[model samples]
Target chain A: MTDIIIAADAWDEDIEGSLLTWIYPDGAEVKAGDVIAEITVEKLQVDITAPGDGVLSHAINEGDLVSKGGKIGALA
Target chain B: MTLTADQPATTAPARKVVMNRAIREALDWELANDPAVFLMGEDLGKFGGVYGTATGFFDKYGEDRVRDTPISEAGFMAAAAGAAMSGMKPIVELMFIDFMGVCLDPIYNFIAKHAVHTGGKQDMPVLIMAGIGGGYCDASQHSQTLFATFAHLPGLKVVAPTTAYDARGTLHAAMRDPGPVLYLMHKELLGLGLWGTMPEASSNVSDAYFEVPLGKAFVRREGTDITLVGLASMTHVASRVAKTLEGEGYSAEVIDLCSVVPLDRKTVIDSVRKTKRLVVIDEDYRTCGVAGEVIASVVEEIGTELIAPPQRVAFLDTPIPFARPLEKFARPDEDKLLKAAMRTLKHA
Candidate 1:
């Protein structure tokens, strides 16, 4: 399984981003580099892309606060 | 240009952006494409707007085009009206919707009445952008979605967009229109990561220029059980309720009334015709507001055809209290919307 990570280096390490919503539904088939979820860090909104082509599984619920480098979802 | 579903798709890739960025991009496009387009508001130039919607515009467009006006709503609003009459398109930002009270004369008397007063000879191509809604503890003074107040007046077009896609398209459409348009942006949906985040508010918006035509109602979800009509923040609420009800074996059609002034009666009536029930959720006040207006229109069209009495979930007539819990109670929410939907279904 390839894990979808909210890259730690994308924003300031001190700020925790909230998973705004999952663009694609859980268990849907997705391709590598396809945007699957959106997160808001401070005032910036960033999209999380799939790491590989596989069935997507959500690791975090929408509106949940997410830390940098944490796994938001996984592609199986 | 007005964009419809039947229109040919552009090759431009869709980018996921917050509502504020989407608005900024639309304004940027208008400013770059048309020399007639310019911006004026308090803190718009240097401060980049209170919500950061105009960030970097001051530098990119310079002081001449991106102007910073004094904290005078009446003054700037009048100036914008005069500028529009003279063939210049001015986009004025009223920091908060609640402040409209201080500048009603200019908006109602001059800006809205210009075209009509001139026998269609003069055109008022002015766009008034304002921040509205109350999710954070901004009290009654700072947080009131007063789109209905403007909609009540004649000769003005009013629009409140729920998502980034609609925000970009509607703003484009509003800017291009020959008359004055009030574009109300809900503070909670601006994607500033303030108060709480609304994931659905952020969407994949196109980079290309397009217009989500005025006087159009977008059916966000198609269903047969009941029709839940909403605008601005309430659109998101109704959508959430619809999704939740889907799992409970109930189908609810969600209609986002993007343009309030025109009141998309046909779409709402059509949906109610199919569902045989109606529920309107509005952040605006219950009395003499969009909720009542929608229900009245639908009832006037097909009152006897409805399977059940329609329900309205909206803000209380009282001012939005300062306390968080009281504000929560006053505003239309998911629970309130769900209950209203369920009630409509039960009546049917």
Candidate 2:
């Protein structure tokens, strides 16, 4: 199994982190480059895409604050 | 930036359009007619604006005039200000009004105060169009409609149009007028196709070129019992409240103060004197806001004639909350305005 960690990309004003929403639920199939979730920041909305095709499992529930560099999900 | 090309208007006829489309159509007119006019903002070219106001603008104007800048507000805002001074009329789109803080220097000291500071010799024909207001669970940072903040500053004309007709005319006036104009459009009225159904702002827009003079108030609905003042989306809220109040045997005069800086004090004062009551609804913070200013102006002008203390329905002086219920509680909605109107009319 490979971990799908939230990218550690630098963000401006990520003060309150982000509320997470999964586009594809756990145990669902996703292809590489598919938009799998969304993270809404204070002023912007960004999509989290699948790094590779696999069966997915979420490390955090919907509406959870996925802090920068935190593990969001895994692919097996 | 293209230096030499004439873009001419090809379409003609009065038509019904949503507020967002009306704004785009206005921009299309300016871009088509004026060779010097160009639009600049982050993601405005390909993304067609966050509110979809510039959806089909990029292909028509191309990259030269329909330019996109990096996410740095201070850098691009300064550039736009400089462009304005150099004879190009630049229409800058600050995606969210909340982001104005990142570029205050250019907005306050330069873009706004330039023409006057230069003894009226230099022309700064720059217009900033920004998306404002809440009710979308966009959190504190993204939700505020800061009309008071800009209107308080010197040398800038601030305007907010509630309907598609007003939107078109106001944009035309802003573009044609010299100096700086802060044109704010409520996000809920933008027709972005993301949120649920939105209330329709009047689409009785003229197809031919026309301008709604700034510093003028539009008496949206006439009444004689109590005067209700509002701006932007709040105007629509007041309109609904007026209808309900009419049903309850209260005549509520709804006034849309289109521009805050050159406030139409005469109209408001005139209405208040006739009605003997006032209710100001503002989307901004209550303390030191547009509502307060209007109330102060009316009281200072005709305090003796007022039968009741002016009531204000405004956002509490605190950061807007992210939660849906909290946002609703904090914002001045239809119910709140109705209560305010009733309070004003019933006052001893």
Candidate 3:
């Protein structure tokens, strides 16, 4: 089965220095624009959205120090 | 943009609504007053406004005057600054104050650094009317009262107008002023109005239109016992708690420190000296909040005049909640204010 991997496009100050929250849980059905995770850095925080509808996969857990070009979670 | 050809300098008396609505009125007035005055934001035109601030604005001036933008507050805010430098009075909005993180690059890197770095030869005439939403279970994403964040920054005139009157007047001033002013218009009080149909700030708005002069403090009430400070929506909250204290025979002087960055230190210091006690009723979280700065200023500037240590009636350093009771408890409501005032008296 093919999976969709949502990676960090860029860093958001809102979520700059904190953990990223998965908007949808692992193994959950998701839709476009449906958020899966949140990250906070310093004084910013934002929820990353699901790219496409699929079964969920989490490559990064909550409170993980995420950087650009890192795979956060996957959708299959 | 389009030379803003719509109404005459004095035309189209719109509906007077809430403080925020009066702000809209002020923007409309400014656009008519100066071809240089324009507004840009995400969903500002076709969507009527993210918060209805630009309702009927698009139909009035069309695209040229009311410019609609993509969801890029950082890029657009800088663009507003650039527009201001090129002689345009552009009013931009960040859907919520929490979104400021997305736009601080423009705020600090340029707006704050430009004038001085340019040897005081540049003019950044941008008014950012950020909708600072909180206290209404907008949840953590939207409910942070970030006055302290912007207030801590220099080269930014941060004004949190609590009343509709102050909102319209201050917004007018910020729009016309020759600098980057961050107008933290509260999202909570956008629904309040003076009368059924009229906004509280409708009357006594700019005759020129008059801009609310900067660096002045408003004494919400005149009392002698304890001096309490409030800013933005907290001014309303303090007035209510002051009344509760008044019934208990404690005369509390409620002063609204309307302008935060260039604070009215003399007014606050003078009040503390008289009352021999001070409690800052702030909307920000404790620990390095506006309260600490004001209190420290009073102590350092006038150390001799004191009856008690200062108290900060502010939210704990935590995100606001969605649960009703948790939200209420997280904020320093009337009960906490009342108790803090009495605690100061004990030290007195």
After aligning candidate 3 to the native by TM-score, how far in Å is the CA of B220 from where it should be?
1.1
Query: Residue-wise lDDT of candidate 1 within B134-178, one digit each (tens)?
Result: 988989998898868888989899999999889999998887789
lDDT of 3 by residue, B74-125 (tens): 8898897788778777888777888888889988888867788788999888
lDDT of each: 0.86, 0.83, 0.72
Clashes of each: 0, 1, 28
Which candidate wins on lDDT?
1
Worst 10 residues of 3 chain B by lDDT: B193-202
How do the residues A1-76 of candidate 2 rate in per-residue lDDT, one tens digit apiece? Answer: 8788767772565454453346566887778886676565553445577889898888887557766677889999
Output DockQ, candidate 3. 0.01
Clashing pairs in 2: B7-B32
| lDDT (Cα, tens digit) per residue for candidate 1, span A27-62 | 877788877776877756676887889988998897
What is the DockQ score, from 0 to 1, of model 2?
0.02
**Residue B116 shift from truth in candidate 2, angstroms:** 2.0
The top-ranked prediction according to TM-score is 1
Candidate 1: deviation at residue B330, Å?
1.1
Rank the models by TM-score, top first. 1, 2, 3
